[model samples]
Target chain A: METSTRVPNPFAKRVIVVDWGTTSLRCMLVEPDGEIARETESSRGIRFIADRAFEPELMNALSSWFDEFGNLPVIALGMITSRNGWIEVPYVRCPATASDLADGIIQRRLPNGADLYFLPGITDTTRQPFPDVMRGEETQILGFGLDKEATIVLPGTHSKWAKVGQNRILGFQTFVTGEIFALMSEHSFIAKAAAKSEGIDWESYDRGVRVAENATAGDAAFLTQLFSVRTGMLANELKSEEMQDYVSGLLIGLEFRQARDCGWMKAGDSVGIVGNDGLNDRYRRAAAIFDLVTVDGGEHAAIAGALEIFASVKARSDAA
Target chain B: METSTRVPNPFAKRVIVVDWGTTSLRCMLVEPDGEIARETESSRGIRFIADRAFEPELMNALSSWFDEFGNLPVIALGMITSRNGWIEVPYVRCPATASDLADGIIQRRLPNGADLYFLPGITDTTRQPFPDVMRGEETQILGFGLDKEATIVLPGTHSKWAKVGQNRILGFQTFVTGEIFALMSEHSFIAKAAAKSEGIDWESYDRGVRVAENATAGDAAFLTQLFSVRTGMLANELKSEEMQDYVSGLLIGLEFRQARDCGWMKAGDSVGIVGNDGLNDRYRRAAAIFDLVTVDGGEHAAIAGALEIFASVKARSDAA
Candidate 1:
C-alpha cells in the first residue's frame, strides 16, 4: 500500500511549483524530492493579473508562506511562460529530455531574494506541413517519466498524443477534441437541443464511440459522424438527455481512431494517460474500447516535472 | 442569350412557398408552373415567433399578397415542421418521388381561408445506428430535378450529400461541416486568434483543401487537422488573415473526401451543388479540386419542388 517513492522532509527546505495558466493559478510547496507539502490555487491567473501586477498578486497570495519560511526559489510553467504572460520563454525542440528542458529555462531574481524560473514549452519540427507545439504539457510528460517506451496521452482543451522512449520526449500530435466538444455541445443545433441532464448516459456515449470505431469506410468521417448525433435524435434513437455525452464519445473516439492512423498507438498496445483534466476516465474508457491498456500516470506530474527540470538546471550550472 | 424553362405568368395562380427555419423565414410567390414571381424574407423564423403568433405574424407579413391573390395556398418546409415548430410533420422515408412527398404533406386551413401545407422532410432509415433526416434540402434536391441521376450537395449549417436517380431520391447523408466551421472560427482558440479580415484568401483556403485531399493518413483526422490551423499560425506558415478561409477550406475539403469514401461520388463524376447558402462557389471550387464536374442547379429549386409536390397532391386527391 505504501508504494510512493516520495522523500520525507528532514530539514523541510521548500520550493514552489506554480502551474499558472490563462484562467487560473495553481501553486504547490514541495520537498526537495518532490513530495508536496502545501497547495493553493486561485482565479488570479495571468488573465486576471492586470497591468503586470503578477508579482504583488502572487506575493499577496503566498504572503504567509514567505513570512514563515523566508524567500523560496520558485519554478513556474504553463501559459505564464508564453508570449502573453510574465516572460516569453522559447520552446525546446523535441526529442527532449530533462536536461534539454532545463537548458531552456529563463530565470530572474525577485525583489524578495527568491529565484524564479520559467520552463520552456516544446516544439516538434518533424510535424508535417508545420511544426506542432505544446506549452506546459511538455513538463507534464516529463513528470510522467520516460523510462518506459510507450505512447502517452495528455488530454486537455488541446489533447496531446506523445511518444516517450530512450529517456527523451519524442514527437507528439495535438487533437482539438475538447474545444470542439465544448463548442458543439454548447452551440451546435443538434447538441443545443439536449435537455440538461444530471448524469452520463453511458449507453448513448458508447453508441457514439461504436459509430466512430466502426466507420471503416473512412475513420475520418468526423463531420458526417457529427451529423449522426442530430439524426439519432430525429430518428428517436437518442434521447435529448443523451446528446451531450454522445457527442463527447463520438469526438473522443474519432480522436483515438485518427491517432492510430497517425501510428500513435494500435490495438493491444498500452498507453499512458497523463493530466488531471477530469477527462481521464472518459479517455480510459475510450482506450478500453480501442483495446488499449491504460497506464495510470501520477497525478502530481506537473510538480514532479518542474522539480526535476529545475534540479537539472541547478546541477548543470553547478557543474559548469 | 437567355434560355429559361421557367414558365412566365400565363394566368398565374400564385402559390407561396415559405422556407421557415430556426433563424430566418424565406417566402416566395410562384406561378402555377413554378416561376418565382416575388420573394420576401424576414428574421421571423420559428425561434423568433412567440406564443404561437405564427398565424397572425405570417398573415400580417403577407396581408398585401393575400389581398391581391385572394387566398393562395402556402407550402411550408424546413424547421417550421419540427416538434418545436408550428407543426410536427413526420419525415417521409427515402427512395421517395415527388408524389410520395406529396402524399406525406400535413395540411391545415389558415384563418384567412387559405390552405397551408407543411411538406414532410425525408428520412434515410438505412443510415447506420440511426435514421438520417433532412427538412428543406430534400425539397431542394427535388427542385434540382430527379430526372438526371446524379449526386447533389446542398451546403448549409448541416450540409447534405444526396443521391438522386430513377425519379426518386435514392439515399443521402448529412455532414455538419458548416456548423463545425462556424463553431471553430467563432469559438475555438486557434480560429478565434485570426484577425478579422474582409474577403476570402483563396490561396490559404486552397492550402487547407490540399491538406485534406492529400492526407495519406486517415481522412477523418479532422480534429488533428483542426489543430493544424493553429499550428500553421504558430509555425509562421499561415498568416492571421488566412486562418478563416484556411479552416473553411479544410472542413469543406474533408467533407468531400468523406463523401467520396461513403461512395457518394468520385472523381470525373458530375455533382450538383444546390442551395443558396452563399457557399456554393466554395463548394464548386472544392468539387473541382476533387476532380468532379460542377452542375448548376436552378436558383429557385425549392419553389419548383414545392409546386411540383403540391400538384402531385392535388392530382392524388382528384384521383381518390
Candidate 2:
C-alpha cells in the first residue's frame, strides 16, 4: 500500500468547498495542502432559498466562486443537500468514515464542466434502534479528528446528542427542549403565568434544575407551577431574569435528564459542544452539574471537514 | 314560608340556552319545563369569533328562534362569557352553588336588540394558594346535581378534575395532558417517529401507565422512552393504535398520579366524570387503576346548568 507523497491535482487542481447552512452559505477556496486562500459567504442558506426552487439559484451563486478558482472542482458539505435545500441526499448510516462521503452527489450542473460532489448526512443505529440525522455537524465532528470515537453534543433549537466511534455515528437522540422552552415562554399560557423579568437569574435556573431532577410521576400535573412565576413577581420574591433562567433551566434540565435516561451519553464520556458561544457556555455550565468534560468546536471544524471532502473528491478524479 | 307553584307559558316563556365552545357555538330553545324545542349550532366559537364581535353574530343566529318564543330572555353559558369570549365575566370562586352563576350578569342587549344574560364561569379558590378555571362545566356540575359535595371529573383537551360540596366547587385542577398527548402523538416529532393507528391497545397503554407510574430518576427519560415507540413499531411488537394509546396512558396516568400528590383527590373520594361518553369511559378505565369509583356526569349538565342559572335570575328578579 505505497501512497504517493505528492498528490496530483486532476485538472485545474484547485478545490472549492461550501458550507451551506440553515441561515447562510459559505464558500472557501482551498489549496492542495489544505490551506485557505480566499473565503466568501452568502446569506442564501436553505431558509432563504427554501421558498423557491434551489438548484438554479445555488448553481448561480456557486458559479462565481468557481470562476474565481478558474473552474475548479467544487464539493459541498452541509444543509445544502437536505430535503429542504438544493438537493436531498439520503443519510448514510453511522460508523461511517471520511471515505464514505468521498463519493457523494452534486445535483446542479455547471457551465465550465467542473466536477462537483456533496457529502451525505450521518445516521446512527444502536440500542433504541432509531436513526439520527446530521448535515453540517458531520463536517465539524470530522474536523474534531473524532474519526475514531467520541460523544458530540450539537446544541440548537432541536439539539442533537450523538455517539461517534470509528469514524461512524454509533447512535444519537434529538431533544426539543430548547424549542419547547421558547414556545412556552413566548406563546403558551405559561408565559402569562410566569413572572416578567429582564435578566438571567442563576438561582431560579438552579431551582428549576432541582425541580426537574426530582420531578416525580405526577410532577407534570403541576404545570400550574408556572403560575408561581407570576405570583413570585407579584410578591417581589423572584426577579424577572431569574424567572427566565428558571424556565430555561427547567426545559434544559428535563432534556438533560431524558438524554441520560435514554443512554444517549454515559458518565465519564468526553462530550464536545458544537454551537454558538453563548449557548456553548450555558451548556458547559449545565454539563458541570453532571461532571462532564466539554470541548470547544469552533467554525474551523466545519471548514476542515468541507476541505477534507474536497481533497478526497479531487484525489478520486485524478485516480480515475 | 309559603311556596306557590306556577307553570310559565311553554311557548311565551321559553328559555334560551347557549353553549359556546372553542370551535363551535350552540343554542337551544327550551320549553318552561326544560324540554328542547329547536336547536341550532354554528362554527362561530371563540377561536373564530373575537370576544367583542360574538354578540352580533350570536344575536343574528338566534333571531328566528327568539321570534318563535316571542322574545324570550336568552341565558348564555360556556365559553361565551369567558375572558376570551363575548363578555369577560369575572370568575366566581368555587364551593359555588348554581345560584352563584344565576346571580351573575343579567339583561344585556345584543346588537340586534335581543336581550341576553351571560353566566359566570367557576373558579376554585379553596385550592389556594392555587386556583383553577372552569367554564361550561360549572353548569354541567350544577346540572348533574353534584353541587352538594362530590368530586366531578371533566375529561377533554384540558381535563378538569374537581371537588364540589354544598353547591360550591370546593377545589379543582386542570391537566393539559390531553392536549400534550395530542400534540406529541399528532404534530410533534414523536408522531413522525411512531406508528399511527386506531383504537387503544390495553397492553401498550398499561405498559405506558406502569412506566409513568414507577419510572425511577435514572429510568425516566422521555426521549429514550419516546424512541422505543418507534422501535416497538419496527419490531412488529406494537401497533400504531397502541402507540397512541400508550402515549395517552402515560400522560393521563402522570396527571392522575400528580393530582393525587397535590391532594386534589383522596383515595376513597367518589369521582364524577363530565364529558362525552368516550372521554368519560377513558377516565373510568384510568381511574379504575387506582381503585376509585366513577359516576356518570349525565348528558344534560350543560343545559341543566344554564336552566339553574335562569331559575336563580327569575327568583332574584321576583324578590326585587
DockQ, cand. 2? 0.16
Per residue, candidate 2 scores C-alpha lDDT tens digits across B128-155 of 2235577777777676664356777788
Scored by TM-score, the top model is 1
Candidate 2 RMSD computed on C-alpha atoms after optimal superposition onto the true structure = 8.6
Q: Which ten residues in a row have the lowest lDDT in candidate 1 chain B?
A: B1-10
Per-candidate total of colliding backbone pairs: 1, 17
For model 1, name the residue pairs that clash. A220-B220
User: DockQ of every model listed?
Assistant: 0.60, 0.16
- As a TM-score, model 2 comes out at 0.64
Judged by lDDT against the true structure, how good is candidate 1? 0.83
Worst 10 residues of 2 chain A by lDDT: A1-10
Q: Estimate each model's TM-score.
A: 0.94, 0.64
